[model samples]
Target: MGSRTQDTEECYSYHNQNQNVDYGRMAEILVRRAGSTDEFTRLTSITWINEFVKLGGEQLVPYYADILGAVLPCISDEEEKIRVVARETNEELRAIKADPAEGFDIGAILSIAKRELNSEHEATRIEALHWFFTLLDRYCAEFLAYLNDIFDPLLNALSDPSDAVSFL
Candidate 1:
């Protein structure tokens, strides 16, 4: 609102910008990283997911869904950044498949989201809710079929004491 306040917000807008990973080429390496035992690599693979999806253009999902599923558990990873990017990448893949030129199974994708919604880890459940809400917003009719199945998770999420999760 004030000039000084605006400048302060801009200053905090970035903490690091020296990243130089060749994300384009990183696509080839990402499949392995997505399935890696090492946390960092699996986490870092999320960024590559976006790059690969973008580079693959339309109808590229069937090839990548398996790899993306492998990275899905990273949403429950201990490291916070990994959880964030795993969710972001999931959104990107969903978008890529939104109007796919090739058929992709919606049920398979939704199954993972359901499991994540009920994850023992709080953050994972929260992350799944974030995606579930977005997907419902974008494709409500498709997801409506699962309303019966999703009721328990939604009720559990509603009772969560975390203000952020409940506010959703």
Candidate 2:
């Protein structure tokens, strides 16, 4: 276990030096790991994702939509540290400007965000709303087709017991 931790640290220490790394695959693996049932596993995955965003920066724009899909649920994780790190990662991904022509699967992200809006966790719902806002802000044209699908969930969220979820 300690060796694994040392190896992870060593790998991240040389993140910039390792230009040949297939970050897209790494992001996909980490995103899948982020969904683990174990809290420790989930937190570790998100932390590595945060580090990846920092190391890869604009180079990671192609994966932003998919990465956001994975991180959205972590916004409401039961673990506070996981929630914090996920939010930070989400923010970094959101700040990056990727061209729609780059073939981003906005539809996939919207599907994930819409599903997250229905999560029992209030934080998840709030984060989902934030996703809607961000998507609309950046891709209004692509988002238009999905407008119909969102109304029902948005209305349901309006009555959510949590004011934060409803108001946001």
Candidate 3:
């Protein structure tokens, strides 16, 4: 069997061939698997996504929105293990030094978060709010440009049935 380092190198090399297709396709796959009815499948996909984020580096910037959209809902997954891995993956993604020049699509991410804020799932809505907080913290100027677009959702969510969603 290959050493862990060798295995990781192989995975990295395999992924680096074409950033656009590889990362985008992988994010799409993870999104589908994360939404699986089977708990094990969801957990496995979340774990892989966490590793993928760690290994993909700046090449992932273009697909950041896709990855975030895929994993954000998992943060509130019914399975505790899935939730934990999903949160870790999100942290890893946030830590990535995404250069805006590398094509980070904040608009797409904002759109996803906005849609998520109206979700039926309480946890999903809560996570979406947390996403806005993170965005405001990191991309304050860019986020302000979309303030009007987001204002209505934030206003509506202020009256959410779940106190947890509104309070956060």
Best by TM-score: 2
The candidates, ranked best first by TM-score, are 2, 3, 1
Q: Candidate 1: TM-score?
A: 0.62
Estimate the TM-score for candidate 2.
0.84
- How far out, in Å, is residue 130 in model 2? 0.9
lDDT of 1 by residue, 8-64 (tens): 233233212214333323444566566666665666566556555665544355554
Give candidate 1's whole-model lDDT: 0.60
Write down the RMSD of all candidates, one decimal each: 11.8, 2.8, 5.5
Compute the lDDT of residue 42 as modeled in candidate 1: 64
Top candidate (lDDT): 2
**Backbone clash numbers for all candidates listed:** 0, 0, 0
**Looking at model 2, which ten-residue stretch has the lowest summed lDDT?**
3-12
* TM-score-best of 1 and 2: 2
Give the lowest summed-lDDT range of ten residues in model 3: 1-10
TM-score of 3: 0.79
After superposition, candidate 1 runs with Cα above 4 Å error: 1-35, 63-68, 79-87
